[model samples]
Target chain A: MRDKFNEQLEQLNVELIKMGALCEEAISAAAKALLEGDAALRETAAAAEREIDQKERDIESLCMKLLLQQQPVARDLRTISAALKMISDMERIGDQASDIAEITRDIEDSPVVSHVPIAEMARSTIGMVTDSIDSFVRKNLGLAQEVIRKDDEIDRMFLDVKDELIRRIGQGDSGETCMDLLMIAKYFERIGDHACNIAEWVEYSLTGQHGDM
Target chain B: MRDKFNEQLEQLNVELIKMGALCEEAISAAAKALLEGDAALRETAAAAEREIDQKERDIESLCMKLLLQQQPVARDLRTISAALKMISDMERIGDQASDIAEITRDIEDSPVVSHVPIAEMARSTIGMVTDSIDSFVRKNLGLAQEVIRKDDEIDRMFLDVKDELIRRIGQGDSGETCMDLLMIAKYFERIGDHACNIAEWVEYSLTGQHGDM
Candidate 1:
């Protein structure tokens, strides 16, 4: 029975990691689609979203089964809870990718004012997300907390993107153009926030406190 | 041990319901402050928020203790997991309320925009959230699903609110004033969506499905 539980946990862990890998790819594809004006990559990011949704369903079922079969306790309980929470953040990260893709689709051929610091922020957030869940699967609290510490820097980068976006809008960009830029900025910031949320959950699983200890 | 477990479960139930009740009140106070033009009520809502945060901390610690002592399984696991998820949603709901309060604080003295459908939407969301948690405490799946169905109404109301706000802004309202309205509308939409999330969890506990099972 114990061995079965371990195997199930292993399956859940592997699936989540795969989902995270897809999310990382989506982030790259979406950002490149926006920055490089590569329309085909936008479709690639959008196509990737359906796979993330499938992965989410697969992992959610695995989690429910783990709860039913494993009957985890204490630290085990924390692991399952953290994994469930991590998936929600992961799914939202996928969502931010989709958001970026949708914006690229809508803004096709429109002249972008500038795409500064957003790709950099996306790179940073993707790294944090990958590392946070890696920390969770590896039971590395130090790495999880390290991801949390980088959250402020992501926020700062988001602000820089926001400042540039706002500067354009204030200079009398049309409502449609300004709205598209604002939405893109919103997606980038949201991706960072979700990574921070995942990192916080990992920390909680390790320390048995939400943002505590 | 069973009796002890039941006692802890009941205590957790009580605390969660209390927090749910507090969340309902905060949303009401936030909407009331906006509708009645009572700037002071925004302060009252802000003060209430601190208590909500404190209550959240207390409940989380209590949940950890229950997990440690009861070491619950099956229905017990479902109950505890449901409580944990519900509390997280309630905290987010409280954050949404605080956002509403902050918007109120910004535009307390600004000219009103025809009352709109905001109060109605806020009331609907608050009631849905209150009842969703109530459904959990009572373990009433039917009631929980009822809350799930109304999520569409909440979304529709949100669209109406957004349309009205944008129309008002387009009519040459101060950009600052319109932004405050936009923020308030967005907060109402989030509170409703969170209520739906709580309802989804309640359904999960009942039928082992994510929502409306």
Candidate 2:
């Protein structure tokens, strides 16, 4: 029975890793679509979002079954519960990525603004998300902490993006274009937040206490 | 033992309602702060946010204890698990409210813009949140659906807010002010999303399937 449980647990970890990879793909596609004015990648990101949603349901059922069939105690219970919470964040990351794609689709034909630091912000956020998931899969507390620390940088980047948009608007740029850029930057910041949340859950699962505790 | 479980469940419901009310207060306070240029009310919202965070931690511990000690199955398990998910949404609602408050604090001394329709959006979102929690407590699937439907109106209002901000920016209004208003409207839209999520979980608890299912 213990061996079977461990096997199932390992399967859960594998599924989570797959879901994380999907999120990474979705966000990276969305970012590239936004930066390159590529409308086709928006569709790609949307498809990935749908897949991520399906993955969430699959992982949720697995966690519920593990909880019910195994009635896991202590660390096992925490791991499953944390997986449950982590997937919600992962699913939202996917949703936010889709949202970014939707916005990029709308602005795909518009004249591109070159001054916003959005591409760099997107890269940083993607790294944070990947590191957070890796921290979870490897149970690396230090990596999780690093993800948390990186959030401040994302926040700062968002402010920079906002300021840049404001400056462009004041310089007589189209308000609509500025608004779209601002929204995309804000989505990247939100994705960073979800990544931080996943890292915190990873920490909780490993140590049985969140960072605040 | 069954009676004790029922009693604990009732207590959990009460706490959830209390947390929901706090969310309503925080959002309302933040809205008033933004509309009235009331910096004091921003502080009030911040205080409520702190309380809401405390309540989340408390409720989480209670849920964990219930899960570990009672080992509930089937419907009972669903209800507890749904509550666990609902609190995360509720906590996010609180955070969004506080975020709105923070933006208002920065703009409180600025000349107020009166055309954003934020007040109506806040009222609609607060109603959705209240109804979602009520649906959970009463197991009212109809009310849950109502809350879900209400989300569309909030989304529409957010678009209206965005349009108004863009119009103002085009009319040579302060870019900073427009950006602040846009962020506040976005936060309200996000609160509506969280409320919809809570309502979906409530529906899941009652029907054993999420809205998507």
Candidate 3:
């Protein structure tokens, strides 16, 4: 019985990693679609978003089963609970990616996007997402802390993007296009936040210390 | 022992209601601050945000203790787990309130804000937050479903706000002010989403049915 419980714990880890991969795929596709104006990549991002949502449901059920059947305690309980929390953030990241894709579908690309550092922002946020999940899979406290710290940079980039967009608007650039780009930038910043949240859960699982607390 | 568990469950309910109250206060203060351009209300919102964050930590610890000591299963376990999930969304509502307040602090009252339906959006979102918590407190599945349905209207208001702001920008209104207004509107929409999430958790606790599923 103990061995089977351990096996189930391992299964939880595998499923979380898979869900993380789906989030990465979704965001990457959405960002690429934004930078390149590629319709195919937008569809890829949307498809991955759907897959991410399904993965959340599946992983949530697995965690619930483990919690109910095994009645895990202490560290085991923490791990499973942390998975429950992490999946919510991961699901939000998928939604943000989809929201970004939706915007791209609604409007054509404007030169205003090239004026801001949005592509760099996306790359940095994607890095945080990748590192955050890696920290969870490896149970690395240092990497988890690093991901948390990286969020400040994303926040700063968002402000910079906001200021630049405001400047473009002042210059009488296409107001709608600037609005869309700002929304896209905001979504990227939000995705960074979810990645930061995932890392915090990793910290909680490993050290029993919630970042906010 | 079962009697003690029942008392603790009641305690959990009380704490959730308290946290919900704090979230409502934060958002309402922020909205009032934006409309009146009142610095005092912004400070009030900030204080509520701090309290909301502390409340999250306190409630999280309480839930963990209940789960660990009681090892609850079935419906009891579901209720406790649902509370755990609900607090995260509640905490995010606090953050959105803070974000809205921050934007108001950065800019003066603009005439453009008066032109948009932002006040209506804020009112609708605050109502959703209140009802979402009320549903959880009462375990009213109908109220929870109502909150979920209301999210669609919030989404529609957001697009309306976007279009109106875009038109203002096109008319050579203050670009920076319009951008700030748009961000504030988006934050309101996000709070509505968080409220919707809390209601969904209420549904899950009551009926074992996740809204997304």
Candidate 4:
């Protein structure tokens, strides 16, 4: 019975890693859609969002089964509970990515996009999302802490995006377009936040310390 | 043993209702601060947010204790798991309210505030938050469904806010100030989304159905 429980726990880790990869794909496709101004990638992001949602349901059912069948305690209980919480954050990341794609699909050629370092922000958030999951899979507290720390960099980048958009508007750029860019930048900032949340849950699972930012 | 478990579950419900009330206080205070241009109310909202956070921690610990001590099955287990998930959305509602207040405290005499129906939007979101919690307490699936439907109203209000901001920008309003107002409206919109999430969790707790929106 103990061996069977361990096997199920291993399966949980594999499912979480797969869900994290889907989030990365969704966000990356959304970012590329914005940077390249390709409406096609929006569909890619949307498809990934659907897949992520399905994965959330599947994993949630699995977690419920584990808890019911094993009645896990201590460390095992914490791990499963943390997984339940972490999936919500992962699902939100997918939604934010889809939202970014929605905005990108409607936007035309806007010069505001070039002035902001949105691509760099996207890359950093993607790294944070990936590393947060890796920390969970490997049970590495230090990597989870690093993921939490990296949120500051994303916040700083959001401020930069805001400042540049303000400058462009002051220079008589289209306010409508700048607002669209602002919304996109805001979505990316939110994705970073959700990634930070996932890392916090990872910390909670490993250390039983619920760290709030 | 079962009697003690039921008592603890009752306590969990009490704590959840208290946390929900704090979220309501935070959002209401934030809306009043924005409408009245009262920086003092920002501190009020911040205080409520702090209380909400503390309540989350306390309730979370209670939940862990219940799970470990009773090893609840079936409906009892679903109730505890749902409580675990609902708190996160409630906590986010508190954070978004504080965020709105933060933006409101910074702005000085903006004409866009009059143009947008922000006050009405605030009232609607406040209603949704209240109803969502009431549904959870009553386990009324219909009330929870109503809360989810109300999110559409909030979304419509957000578009109105966006359009008004765009019109003001065309008339040469300060782009920076309009951006600030937009962020505040977005925060309200996000609060509505979180309320919808809470209602969904309430439905799940009662019916064992995870309805994604």
Candidate 5:
């Protein structure tokens, strides 16, 4: 029975890794779509979002089955609970990426990446998402902490983007354009937040406490 | 053993209702602070947010204990899992409300409620939060669906707020003020989304499936 439980646990890990990869794909595609003004890439990101949603349901069922069959305790219980929390964050990442894609599609005529370091912010956020999942899969405490630390950079970049947009608005740029760009930047900031949440859950699963304890 | 589990489940319900009340308080306080330019109310919202966070940790520990000790199956398992999901949404509602209060603090000199129907939006959103939790506590499917449907109104209000902000920006209003108001509106919109999530979880807990089968 113990062997079977361990095997199921390994399967849960595999599912989580797959969901994380899909989230990365979704966010990266949304970023590329925004930067390049590529409507096709927006569609790709939307598809990835749908896939991620399906994966969430699958992984949720798997976790439920493990809990029911094995009734895991202590560290094992924490691991499953953390997985449950992590997937919600992952699912939100997917939704936010889709939201970004929607914004990119709205602004297909005039991409907003030229005036701000939005592409850089996107890359940074994507890295945080990837590293947070890696920390979870490997139980790497250092990597998890690093992901948490990266959120400050993401927050700073969002403010920089806001400042630049304000300057452009003052210079008589289209208000609608500036607003769209700000919304996109906000979406990236939120993606960073979800990544931070996943990293915190990873920490909680490992240490049974979250953040700076 | 079954009676003991049921009693603990009732305790969980009571705690959830309490957390939900805190969220409503936080959002309403933040809204009042914004509308009235009342710094004191902002502080109240922030305090409520801290309380909500503590409640989340306490409830999470309870859920973990219930899962590990009872190993509840079928409907019982679903109830616990739904609680897990609901608390995350409720916690997010608290965070978003606090975020609104932070924006209120930043714009104490020039309140943003004059040009938009922000007060109405706040009232509607607070209603949704209240009804969502009431549904969870009472297991009222009808109320849960009503809360979900009410999200459409909140979304429309957010768009209206955005359009008004854009118009203000076009008329050479302080971009900073307009941006801050837009952010505040977005936060309210997100709080509504969280309420919708809690309502869905309430449905899932009672019905074992989420949304139109």
Candidate 6:
């Protein structure tokens, strides 16, 4: 029975990774749609949000079923619960990606601003998300903690970029497009937050640590 | 044994409610500190934040113990997991409240511009936080959904207030002070998001639903 539960858990881990892949895809689409101004990619990512949504629901139900039917024991129980927790953050990461894409769609015709800081935030956040799951699969609590530690950097970058944007708009760049830039910054910050959450899930799974952040 | 497990679950619920009460206290202190420019209140809220953080860890540890020992079936497992998720959100809400208090400390002399919208946002968000817990206690999906629906109002109010603050600051209000105001709006928005998360957790406990933002 324990082996069967582990098997189910393994499948869950796989499905969750797939979901994470989609989130990365969506985030990539968001940046590409904005920097490249590709409307087709924008539409594709927007439509793909629903798929991520459905996967979240599906994984949630599976987790629920695992808890009820498999009656997970020991670390398995914690692992399944952690998986459930991670999925919510991952799904929200997808939402943030979609939100970024929406902003990109809105600002398609706007004058270009330097995308360096925003991309830097996304790249770091995506790294966290990936590493968190890798740590989860390997039961690497140290790696998970490492990911959590990096959240401070993500937050600092978010603030730096936000302050810069606010200062720019403060300096008379108050075009209607400012909101889109603000929203993009907001979405990137959210992705970083979700990455932090993913690391927390990894910690919860491995050593029962909760909310070092 | 089953009776003892049920009792422990009930006790867990009670403890979560206690944590919720702490969250409630923190939010009020933070809001008052922000609006009334009370320095001591900020310190009080910050101290309360420490307590909330400790309570969160304790609850999570106790919860993991219960899950490992009781091996709860179906509803019991759901309830326990739901509490785990809700407390995370609630604790984050506590952090946001303290964040608001800290921001208040930074900009104590800034004169208030428009209180009604932000005040309304705080009121509604607080209402959602309270109602989400009530719904969890009552196992009322409808009540939880109500809180979820009210989140839109809180978001709308947040956006309106933020825009107004930006406008006022643009019109010669202190830019330095606007940062404080922006942080307050951010804290309020975060609190609202956490309330929505709590409501979602309540819904998950009752029906295992987990999607649609």
lDDT of candidate 4 over B97-192, digit per residue (tens)? 998998886675676777788888889899998999899888899999999999999999998898988888888888888998888888899999
Alpha-carbon runs more than 4 Å astray in model 5: none
Residue-by-residue lDDT tens digits, candidate 3, A8-74:
9888889888988899888988888888889999899899989998998888878877776777877
lDDT of 1 by residue, A74-134 (tens): 8787888788778877876887798788777666655553545666877887898799879
Task: Kindly list the per-residue Cα lDDT of model 2 for residues B1-213, writing each as its tens digit.
Answer: 888888999999999999999999999999999888888999989989988988988898788778767879888989998998899899889989999989986776555357778889999999999999999999999999999998999999999889888988998889988888888899999999999999999988998989865
Model 2 misplacement above 4 A: none
Overall local distance difference test of candidate 2: 0.89
* Quality class of the docking in candidate 3, CAPRI style: medium
Q: What DockQ, on C-alphas, does every prediction get?
A: 0.20, 0.60, 0.55, 0.57, 0.68, 0.22
Clashes of each: 0, 0, 0, 0, 0, 0
Q: Point to the candidate with the largest TM-score.
A: 5
1 or 3, greater by lDDT: 3
Residue-by-residue lDDT tens digits, candidate 4, A1-213: 899999999999999999999999999999999999888899999999999999998898788778777878878888998898889899999999999999886675676777889899889999999999999999999999999999998989988888888888888888888888888888889999998999999998898887972
Q: What order do candidates take by DockQ, descending? A: 5, 2, 4, 3, 6, 1
| Error of model 4, residue A46, in angstroms | 1.2
lDDT of 5 by residue, B22-139 (tens): 9989999999998888989989999999999999888988987788789888878888988988898988898889989998877776744587998998899999999998998888
DockQ score for model 2: 0.60
- For candidate 3 chain B, which ten residues in a row score worst on lDDT? B105-114
- Judged by lDDT relative to the true structure, which candidate is superior, 3 or 4? 4
- Candidate 3 deviation (Cα RMSD): 2.0
Please state the error at residue B1 of candidate 1 in Å.
Answer: 4.7
Q: State the lDDT of candidate 6 residue by residue for B1-213, as single tens digits.
A: 878887887888788888888888888888887677778998888888888888887887777667667767677777888888788888878888887887776676566534436566667777888898889988989998998888888778777776776676667665556655765776788788888888888887788666554
* Candidate 3 stretches greater than 4 Å from native: A69-74, B71-73
